[model samples]
Target: MSEWRIYQGVGKPHDGIDRLPAPPPWRDFGNGEGEMTPFDRDMPAQGRHRLPHAAAYQADESTVEAVNTALYLRRPLLVTGDPGVGKSTLADAVASELKLGAVLRWPVNSKTTLRDGLYRYDSLGRLEEAGVAQRGARQDEQPTPASLGRYISLGPLGTSLAPFALPRVLLIDEIDKSDIDLPNDLLDVFEEGGFEIPELARAADVSEPVMIRPADGGEEVTVRRGMVRCHAFPFVVLTSNGEREFPPAFLRRCVRLQLPAVSEDEMRLRAIVRAHLPGADEQAEEIIELFMQRAATGELATDQLLNAVYLMSRTVKEGAPGLDGVARLVLQHLNVTAPAE
Candidate 1:
């Protein structure tokens, strides 16, 4: 409720984002009315998975603090955690709670580059189309056809950078999975809140401001003079499974949060179970205890706990219900394989 804390984590829609003071001169892109993506429109009807995941997310004290800090500072949250500790769900929770619309996610991989997150142009396709156009045109006339904007579409990361009044939630899942230097490459854009689309920039003189579909879907965004800037910095969540190290500069810019081990939080686990399988409370604790035991041995995911409980509820006939064979299979670790006979 404090004036400085824009995100309350209450999971209710509010205009608090509007009340947020202007970003420090450096982070503020401009005052222009930003475009609204489909997610920025009616969310309840967007048929997105964000709401349900948001409803189920149970934020602890540390999570709430880190989230608010990132929101208030307009910085990316670098969430480091064991796999499946709900690192990525944080984006959905904030988007759903704040009525920010759908989360724009760019799932990073070994081959992902900064440009991969940006717009993609069908250069060859355009070339081929131009060839066809030239062939069809009259001998004395010029070949006239569509513009390059028709071949360009923004990706999730590019769409998030679109000038928007309120921020969109962008989940850069598994940042550690990206090749080295990618995080460094992102620093400039993160600070500038925009990037020049060379394809559009080069054609700026030849074309009017282009109207093109954004990756987030819904509304067409206007790209003027080949540059995209934001009125507000989108809330960015970069998740890492502690898979690799990031450059110190990237670390400094991000509000780093290392999620507490899920096994250590008993009450939190129970709450998660209650949120998911309301009636499974009867055997939830037993399943959770075993899950924690397995988690202690090696890598484990929170979903495995949910999966086990769901199975137990259906199969726990009269008394046989303590981490049964079927449940053990579900609780298997991502890193630890089953012991040989």
Candidate 2:
């Protein structure tokens, strides 16, 4: 059995509503033509990075259910939670447990756009290279069309939508920070299972099928006629800090799940502390109690507690002084309001 229960549902469930009858087979019905390389060959050897303490991180039942639902239905999972609640880490856990290649990440910002997620074309660099080629050409030699493939590279979304033998796992971090239109803009791509690259499309006649680099960085793949479509839809995990609301249309297409506060459970808090600071004993309980008390009064993130535990553990191990004062400083709540006089 896998260390995590989430991986057990890889291809088993089929309720038709949230689960598909079977995994979608790889098939290309669009203008794009390409083959997905095996995970061991094309993917980076490092796999997804995991913290030493992440082994003990646990997910609630609802969160696990949401992940399985998204996997079976091939739908994007919209995870909303407070900061440091492990919204983004969920994608890493899924990729790690399922043995999915790598997590293609797109960190969203206030200015992020839909096109930014699809691909980026370095026209200027290509032009510079073309100039160099032209100047070096002999009197009888002619420069061929600048390699369009060299200039274009796929982004997170495009890479996910590429024709892969198995579905790629994608993490769109802090999507709530994106512009209002970004969510709606992603609807078409999510529904269509593909997107077109106009730059490559315009040059299709000259460049029938070109090998281009994908976002994940590895061997290049052939893109036929500038159209990139997916045989297997990517398992997309979009995270938000609950800073903004999304359109109903966007929400309709996604499976939504909210992460509950960890401070509510004493056992869970202890587990997190033990994972991060294995040496912590009675100190772990004291710190967790203090953390819960502070959390109950103001805005606090789980990482703050972890940081305190780590510092205290290090201090004790090194026989350092001022452990209490240091813990107090690091464990202080982040609330801006002034404490009672």
Candidate 3:
């Protein structure tokens, strides 16, 4: 197994690096007589869509420094880079390294909204459930208190802000793909460290601490008075493909870092390749050079290189020289220049 370096705070405040005190644990907050369960902290080493490259992914010093700065300052890291440059994978790497549990990923599309990322209340579902209970009950019996807990669940962002022993890792993937107003809407929640669920708030007066499930489908957590606040701010990673520009205010609140484009650096390429394709060190140089050459001509992603290498490796092991043609198909450049209109 490869040894991973966890991000410790910087020694002094320099180049936007500010030292910060350790975040307080959830236990520090007072817990009244109620069932208080922490967010699921037990994340398996592998899962569907989880990055297998997390353990061995190698980041440059500057990227590492920026991540540490974000951690210490309790600010979101806005990572801008081309697709497949490992923007989304950064969240996985950090979570795996810091033992921060499963990453809460909110994949943004044009239809995604602030409410979609926070929480969703199924009012209709609750009403139907209530009606069923009332019909089955005796004339004197009362229906359940809406059973809002069953209908209301926190989304990825909401779950991240839930008071946890340690901060959770949140990946707001491809913010550039979201609607224009989405970025601005996120500013308030990011600064406030929480949001209010109106449905839960209205019922707060009548109910005990409501137990709600998060989007991860993990253990239930108790939300007091329908407001979800972070005892420790989540380690947020917002990725962009440089498709759209963000407002000044949103950019100011985030710590921005742009990953390097294509590079011929042998060590960097080897580290990345070795993570996905172990024991391919002998073929790293040849494949990495070919990848760089292709990337120079068009918009080629790093994953394309990995795919090509994996196919080539299989062919070599099986002594199938004829399979070289099939391997070339995988290495084709994804982007072609548009013709003049």
> 246, model 3: CA deviation in Å?
0.2
Candidate 3 per-residue lDDT over residues 99-155, each given as its tens digit: 677899999999999999999888888677667767888446443323677788899
State in Å the error of residue 59, model 1. 0.9
- TM-scores, one per candidate: 0.91, 0.85, 0.84
Higher-TM-score candidate of 1 and 3: 1
TM-score-based ranking:
1, 2, 3
> lDDT tens digits, residues 38-78, model 2?
44422323645544433455677787789877876778999
Task: Report the error of model 3 at residue 3, Å.
Answer: 17
How far residue 308's Cα lies from its native spot in candidate 1, in Å, is 0.7
lDDT per residue as tens, model 1, 113-203: 9998988888898778768877888345432212777888888888888877678888999999899989999999998988988877776
Q: Where does candidate 3 clash, by residue pair?
A: none
Cα RMSD of all models vs. native, in order, equals 2.7, 4.7, 5.6
Please identify model 3 stretches exceeding 4 Å from their true place.
1-20, 23-37, 46-50, 133-146, 317-327, 338-341
Clashing pairs in 1: none
lDDT comparing candidate 1 with the true structure: 0.80
Candidate number of the best TM-score: 1
